[model samples]
Target: MGRTRDRLKKAIAQSRIPSSHGIRYANELLALGAWFREHAEGVPAFARNRDLYAHVNEEVLGDAPIDLFEFGVREGSTISKWMEVNSNPASRFFGFDSFEGLPESWRGGVGETPAGSFATGGAVPRLDDERVHFVAGLFQETLSAFLTQDYRPTGNRRVLHCDADLYSSTLFVLATMHPWLDPGSVIVFDEFDSPLHEFRAFVDYTSSYRRRFRAIARTGPLLARLAVEILE
Candidate 1:
């Protein structure tokens, strides 16, 4: 009887029929492909760093002092890139990270990312410039305090660079930054297509707050830039 059952299970495994999860994943991919097809021209145009930099430069007011924040500053590469492209001398850059990778697993247990996957051993990189600053520790521990006390109003033109890859982390950061996000603020997501993480978080946040944000530019399906129109 045991041998017969094992053979039956093996046959099922070898069959062409896919599991429920497989079907769902296929459907989701199809939907994503359809979306890409609909937004074809813009996807390729803004996929490169130079193009994104050009768009940001045009979007921001040249005379205003820039207030830029990066959520996941891994080895300080992107921050450096931003500083390099920015011609405004008064622009201030803030990079936030635990330097110890993700605080928890993303998308429950199904997702492959493990906790502490991007850990940097708490070693913050030196940007050398006095205009740039690094905030160490998890977002939950440092974000609120930074907003309340340390973050002085420089200019209305602000840019938030989100690299943290998890629904919880993204949601928390959005909610915490809500009050400060006014008109002309740009939020860039580095991993926007992680459906269970960034995509879901953005949808839930916008719906809950009734905020009106437009996707001004995108660097392929992975990276997207949204311009805020919030009043308060």
Candidate 2:
């Protein structure tokens, strides 16, 4: 397991953050998840193992070939969820992370950085979904050409999620994906009320364009995540 995870982490760190890489990765994980569940399948303590991911994916994916991504896939929960519902022989999920751990400068919530939170710090949980894929290291990049590479089969374009806790990382993704997004594309912000820089930067950047954003979904909490549509 250690060797497998290390290999996955390495691939995520080195490859481009492709739109389809994630889904493919999740599908590959299914065998491992099933194997673990086999031995511990009936245990009550494993209740959390109801496979939340499968439930979410089934509801969201249907029979379509959707391309999914998680800006902050800490321990791969959301990625797992995407895998459960969408992991067909044909789906793609991409997860980005700073695998070594959170950045020392990730201050964006109410006050200080989320304490004892963020990445699980433990091994990634098992799940048998080949659609999920992880990309380690920071997206501290300026150029956005990575968005166009290794794309999946879909009309939705790219779905770029900004969950980098810090203000700068969030803004960077918005600016980068801006040119690539089409009408149906969506951007999910993990913390819109970040006291740091995210809220201000996104507000300021969108304001410059005649096309502002329209809120589509919000999970709640003052600084909760946000999903909005970028006007054309």
Quick one: best lDDT, which candidate? Answer: 1
TM-score list, all predictions: 0.78, 0.60
Model 1 Cα lDDT, one tens digit per residue, 133-167: 99998899999999999999865478888889888
lDDT against the true structure, per candidate, is: 0.70, 0.52
How many steric clashes between backbone atoms does each model show?
0, 24
Cα RMSD, each candidate: 8.2, 16.8
lDDT of 2 at 92: 72
Worst 10 residues of 1 by lDDT: 222-231
For model 2 the local lDDT of residue 227 reads 54
What value does the lDDT take at residue 73 in candidate 1?
95
Clashes of 2: 24
